[model samples]
Target: MPDPELPVITLEELGVLRAVHVRGTDSVEVELTPTYTGCPAIEAMSTDIERVLREHGMRKVSVHTVLSPAWSTDDISAEGRRKLREFGIAPPRVRQASGPKEPVAVELGPTRTSRPVAGPPELAPVPDPVCCPHCGSADTELLSRFSSTACKALRRCLACREPFDHFKEL
Candidate 1:
């Protein structure tokens, strides 16, 4: 099945097509998970799936959306990432579970006690250094948070001086 957003990548490669259930003859149910909540392409994808199934002579076809176990950038297949990069969109970096290692703390000012600072957990990973899709240069700068699509961001490479879209990690 094709991805409505990125047509070059299939739904399977996008990791949204969860499963296909066939109930007896002439009945089929397709399970899908959206890349993000309230994704604009979800309804289009469902419609496409049903149309394809009907064209294949299925009398009854139902598309179900599953939201549990929210989708992540990790869900994108290796092939998908490769395709995305080849299409001039930088693929998301694998999210790090923990922040960078911190240096050992030292007590100063005759105070032996030091209190740890607490903050809310980060909702998303810090943006990784982006490489230019045109010249493969690591010296790229983010131009804007939003790109042509909601999931991407605008960036420019210092080497090639070319602007490109980066697929932001969820």
Candidate 2:
């Protein structure tokens, strides 16, 4: 049971801390999700969690690693978003699926021509899908998919030209 007074955050919201389940007074199970598929922080994080739980008198603490139900920016809570920005990282933008055949451009040839030429509109894509913390610029460009970690991407602000990390979209 979750405490009502305390704010509830998904494991992703906590970043390192995943799920904690209490089986009994002495037995407990913890589920951990890595920042990336090959993240090295897993060892350190697992040790830290173990130490903390042990300190709290969790005797039979078992840490289980889960990879399913992949992590996503949506899984991150508002508080998590705040923390990420504070840590100099941008959150992933929420992208809704557009309707099928959302016409970009439909060009009807010359006034007398009957041929119809349809092409994708040249509308500027969302620069920074997520709002940029630096310079408060939403206009951003994806620098690299691989940042310092696989879970983050290197993004550059078009207005500021300052590069920052963007949390991956799941």
Which one is best on lDDT?
Answer: 1
lDDT of 2: 0.61
Error of 2 at 80 (Å): 0.7
Candidate 2 lDDT tens digits, 65-165? 77765444455667777766766678665443433322223332343222233444454232325557677687777667678766677888888888888
In model 2, pairs of residues that clash are 128-140
lDDT of 1: 0.81
Query: Can you write out model 1's per-residue Cα lDDT over 1-170, one digit (the tens) per residue?
Result: 87887887899998899899998788999999998899999999999999999998899999999996677777788899899889998888766445552332333332211122345446432335777777889888778778888988888888988989988777
Q: What clash pairs does model 1 have?
A: none
